[model samples]
Target: MTQSMNHEETFENPIIPGFYPDPSICRVGEDYYLVTSTFHYFPGVPIFHSKDLVNWRQIGHVLDRPSQLNLDGTPSSRGIYAPTIRYHQGVFYMITTFVESKKGARRNFYVTAENPAGPWSDPNWLEDAPGIDPSLFFDDDGRVYMTANRVPPSGREYPKHMEIWLQELDIEKKQLIGPKYSLWDGALKQIHAQEAPHLYKIEGQYYLMIAEGGTGFTHSVTIARSESITGPYENCKMNPILTHRHLGRDYPITSVGHADIVQTQNGEWWIVCLATRPYGGEYRNLGRESFLVPFRWENGWPVVNPGKGIVEMTTKRPHLKSFPWPTRPACDHFDTPQLDMAWNFIRTPRDHFWSLTERPGHLRLRLKPERMTEICNPSFVGRRQQHMTFAARTMMVFDPQNEWETAGLVLLQDHDFQYRMESALHESKNIIRLIKREHGEEEVIATQEIAGQRLYLKVEAAGQDYHFYYARHAEEWQVLAEYMDGRLLSTDVAGGFVGAYIGLFASSQGHDSLNVADFDWFEYIGVPQQ
Candidate 1:
């Protein structure tokens, strides 16, 4: 439940890895709190805690209640966007946009809490707030300001001609009360998708930091400054203080943008940003992850990574003491009263389709009518595929009473793209089948009759190749599918804002069934490729 301090002088680049992206950082006294966007996933916006700014541990989620967020049929990459976390006067506030699928409308809202560990308050929705990636700034003059991306009143003059806007927020009423002003768009007038703005008043001047050029290969971080909160802001000579676009297509880390800067208690400055690790060519199965880079203000402008100017895989640690978390368990035995923080559901569950007390020491999942192929919540539970070289396995006792019911494991990219291995009865015989769904089309890869009453399912990944295995007896494994293409699970091909996941699933496929999949245990582990 806690992390021990490490005395190491160096730490890795991605302080936090996997699918977590769009990192926003804030420091309270000596303790640092960070949050990241979780699109199309339940319990949106995970909050992390760190002491040294290098090591971190997930404390909880910012939106944990169903009443706070509703993503019943949200498509992949279309739910929660970027979030900015700010602390003020004994109160913690988190502001972000909920990107709705209905005509692509976005609603900006914020939630507050006294403790970041959180029994957070309901969202205080902001009216007249358009666009996404909303941020909050608490100025020292007893005034609060909200900044976000929006189009000009006259509309855009060119493609991706977005603008950053500023408005005064009433701290007491939680609403915008002053005239809105359009801040600087970007140093490059034609920069595409200019967004993710964070305001800071430093050294008698107000500074505006933002992400520009979209969230792809051309993604970048830019800065501007002004003497007043809402006025003519001057662009930094080195506008893009951080980016990986010019490094070419084969860089280890690409799409490096959406950064938030924080100054440590020791007075050292750092930037936390989201970037993708593309392996086996340009396929990023790990999705956009959070990375930390050294930052400082030089000549009244921000300088990222200084001499290097690029995000590194390993770098010097912060001046503060290390706060390394104890190694997390690679396996969950389903003995706990609740699911671990590592698990997340796709969209929000409208009803109880899963339980822990039903089968004592086992996670029981009911065979629901909903399927993963659609946007609606299905009978599934999953965790991120953290390592490029990893293995995920689960021991389950499931027997398909009919051909309409299937329950087992899945290697999922999104609702339309995935590789599902499930248990069923073929010709009245127990069987396990491997099926793939790409772009709403599904094809069965392999099928085999399973032995014994219980089934063991597993999938292993070595870089980009995924191998599926199964066992009917303890320690006796058989290859159901080998060297299956994993690139189909990448955002490059699947086109989403999420990474791949290994999860437990049970579906009736539009049929009514009184069946359940009892998972005795689930294990996921990462290893260095041999």
Candidate 2:
């Protein structure tokens, strides 16, 4: 076993930081693959690959095609839930549930691909599979089982009452067969919302691990084991193998659960899960991020973080050799043929609405009739605000002939809660405006008229407070809005399962327009925390 390393060599927690939640990982040989939930964002389920478990790079997304993912009219935080990725017989199977479709329908589906990256098959809808967080387990005898959380057939005694269910799966036929059986309710009695179940067979025992106590401050990971795959599983005496809930709200890391484990080629065990790094008193603008923790077997159960028993902000590196991956570019010049993996749209993007090749070295966004606040797809593309203190700047040249057309930078959380700073023609004058929307009410906090066509817009965040600035020249920046409360863009205030996104947006306000906005470049710089 590898001993703890010096501080200089230690890897940081939240190995894959920023809005990457509900992490599910699978190891094949020396390679480790991971997947995270992307609610309502098209090209969903970002897949990442790592060699040493500490350094990871996003290889691709599972649902890259519009046909594979349909999020039209789906609410901001209501489309795709937790997704579980598993490798079986040279094929990668990703199972997930789509809740609140355009027509308000919920469904479960799975997709398969020979490789972890690219060209994944279209959704094989599991018409009979009920519930979210579906996981596929291939037994030693080549039998496949699907495990997920669903309402008990006997009816719920209380709200959010759920149990783990297992059913036989036919891989070739792409369907679930045989009788469904309840494996374990949960580790705690009367605990609602027991979900994100993953089954493993180790040393002749079938172990079932699950996330309980919801996904909030009380989130936890509990384990149960049984003699048979389908049997009366018994809860572990040292239940809740990992959690940060009991550490109090003052803890740096909160909401730690929904973990997936993998044993390395050198026989080292590690767990990757979702946890939040809150700033300025229990408010997390970065949302739940992927965190890593080392664990060891005690008697038979895994002891997470060993003597610590709680997730730490920094931990010793995995025993395997370090394989450092290149970091994403700090600025995007729109020179690439396609948007980087870091960029995502609100929903399914209209093919002709945006492009990078239309004008060399620029991202052109055509004016769309739908407003940014609408449920439909808007001409918007953004990256997650991954840091508590950062500055996001974009240079745009928009010549709006009418008041209906607007384009600029936005710090968006959802429809009702967002901050938009844009340049538009108001009263036949080219004016820059700063608007804030809270719970469906809109307010124009700042506005300025300028003569230049090229404008530089920036939003600087410092500990839950954001400052909006614009410049006619590249170096001259004037504050347009100051000390704007960023908490309004948080999940706690916005009431969603997503984090803040900073991106370029264009809207026509229900009027057809041929006008387009050209973004010369976009840059994001993380400010060091004090």
Candidate 3:
């Protein structure tokens, strides 16, 4: 699908792939920083840096500390959502919402950092912020404004009747003040889910861009303009500046929306949006990813993707210099003192369950009583499954004393839906088994008796078909399971907003154990698309 007339001039879609969604970008001087939501995953809102817009490198996470975010009982896809990153004067601000569904609450907050890489301040919760997808707009007069999506004051006339609201934000006090004004009700009022509001001042007019028609197949980006920041805005005649809904279901890219615009130092404009790539018929296991598109100002309104009119699978790269960073290796040896930024814990770990220096060159996880079936923090660390054709392997050594102890790899969608391959003592026999947990039903699909405790577990995916294999040593390999339903890890079947994650896990069922599972090395490699 990547048709490059001049090969070096074009860059592919999804500059940053996998489950990164609700992308927002802001450029300060020559450096550009972007952020995306990380729902239910610890160390939320990963920040990426880029110079040319075609290549990016992840600097760190905005919420890296356990004190910055609390996801103790938050369910998958319901925790953090729609982070917006903006820089003002000398500080960078990242604002987002934390949905504590167990408490039926949505708390909006912003954190500031002098350097975007580390030491982000703790949450500065807004008292009057009453909605999700909150964004900040800094005006020329040194005044700050906040906008978010909330229910219409008059309530719903149709389904999902949400409206964007704007109010003055006293940045010094860390709260919203003054009168709140209800802004545009979206381009198509009948098609709801109006959210992801971002206010921009372009050509001396206040322009508001938002995502409408939900975040599914009908997702889109719409624009409106107002002479005043707190006034009645007029929708663009050609609204829905970007979308792929009309391209039918078979299109490679769909559900394109929730965008944020950035103007480079050279005066070129670009957009970063969230879109899904469904390889296997309406099933997007990789979740909504960060996509880049060309943008321009036409007459009085903004245009997306220019001549193409839709977010293409491949398009022209930005006009900036082609800057590329040093390549990263596909394998992690667990020799570093700290975990890599790519790895994440499920929820907050109240107790220390993982270590790196304990065994010097291995990631050791103590087998805890909590299981992946529950909402508690089991001994698990996961990363996004970034490719459709990828193979991941890990070498681990563990001893299962009883049937209650288990350790292995887990392809997780959520607590209710997962595929677990573990080395456990089944009937007092050392067995490597594959268990399928779908829609709350647990069933053992396959089991193979293996020798010794040193194991090599691997999983491979070719399009929608997934295969699981294991070995007693590095070279001797055998298939444990094949042709399993990979759609079980998709949002369509799992009913979550997040993507599938491959994780390392250890569990003791309900019994307390002092044993640990040590992973010496882990590697993931993806094949280039043909």
Candidate 3, 192: how far from true, in Å? 0.2
| lDDT for predicted candidate 3 compared with the true structure | 0.91
How well is each residue in 1-530 modelled by candidate 3, as lDDT tens digits? Answer: 22224535788778988999999999998899999999899889999999888799999999998899999888778889999999999999999999998457889999999999978999999986887999999999999999999888888778888999999999888889899999977555656999999999987999999999989999999989999998789898887899899999999999999999998887878989999999888999999999998788888888877778888777877667778999889999999999989999998888889999999899999999999999877899999998889999999999999999999999988999999999999888999999999999999999999879899999999988999999997878899999998999999898879989999999999999999999998899987655
Q: TM-score per candidate, in order?
A: 0.97, 0.97, 0.98
RMSD of each candidate? 2.5, 1.7, 2.5
Instruction: Please tell me which model should have the higher lDDT, number 1 or number 3.
Output: 3
For residues 209-298, what per-residue lDDT tens digits would candidate 1 score against the true structure? 899998889999998999988979998888688999999999888999999999877677899999999999999998899999988778
Write the residue-wise lDDT of candidate 2 on 244-297 in tens digits. 878999888999999999998878788989998888787878888999998999
lDDT: worst 10-residue window of model 1: 1-10
> Pairing residues by index, what is the TM-score of model 1?
0.97
- Residue 55, candidate 3: alpha-carbon lDDT: 91
Model 2 stretches with alpha carbons more than 4 Å out: 1-8, 101-104, 528-530
Instruction: lDDT for model 2, please.
Output: 0.89
